[model samples]
Target: MKQRHEVLFKQLESYRSYVLSVMENVTEEEAEIIPFGFKNNIRWNLGHMYLDQYLWIQAVTKEKCGVPEQFKSWFGFGTTPANFNSETPSLEELKNLLKEQPAKIKDVYGERLEEEFPPTEMGMHTIEQVLIRTIFHEGMHLQAILDLKKCIQPSF
Candidate 1:
């Protein structure tokens, strides 16, 4: 089971790389643009994925948010990116943090997938299920980053 968890964690690392590639060379202004019909930009989508994943872990493990305090308000699930003016972490900073996340997850929970969590309201009883859901969530957001990239690119 731990070996399976390791594979899932590697997938998470791949997802992070996918996000970085999708966002490569994106400008802050472009990242903040709310293209027609989209709810967020590359920036918000990137940050949201991180914060949302953190929240999911918190929910499943009863652990506190390991991310910065602002993540909860600025990029937390449902936090909109439109007209954002306040100071937020730069994309590079976020990128660095994003890169560091999976290693941290593996260090902390790598061997503990069989550990039982409080029964999830959503019915996830083991760490593996919760982490698998995390991978699914990351994949969904990775696709969103691609969608946003298309929307932000100037259509000829």
Candidate 2:
């Protein structure tokens, strides 16, 4: 039987593919365009997804953030500010990272997570619970990207 983590891994893999397909042929301007001013650009959302995963699987695990430092600020957890500078990785790089990250997590999933991730803290979840939260969060953003694409390019 597949473990819960395995199931989640598969779902995350599909979500990653969905995100990539949405942005595959996008121009830089389109990637950065924030439709309705209420949502983040696709580029920022992608980076944030990467960063959130990295923080959970790596930072929370007391391992390295596998992604480059120069691009960290753009996607680093708790770093998304309304007026923050947006730095984007090339499409090739982003696609590769999205593909690579799930494998990396699977590789390390069996290792004991050293940090104590409490279920709640001050009426909120601890970091571990937050990681699970991010999985759903990424899914929501992926859907948003699809909706945004339809809005921006109706014929697509």
Give the per-residue lDDT of model 1 (tens digit) for 87-144. 7877777787788888887787778777888877888877678778877887887787
lDDT of each: 0.76, 0.64
Q: CA shift at 104, candidate 1, in angstroms?
A: 0.9
Worst 10 residues of 1 by lDDT: 81-90
- Give the Cα-based TM-score of candidate 2 against the true structure: 0.71
TM-score of each: 0.88, 0.71
lDDT of 1: 0.76
**Model 2, residue 106: displacement in angstroms?**
0.9
Candidate 2, backbone clash total: 0
Off by over 4 Å in 2: 77-87, 111-131
What would the C-alpha RMSD of candidate 2 be, to one decimal place?
Answer: 3.9
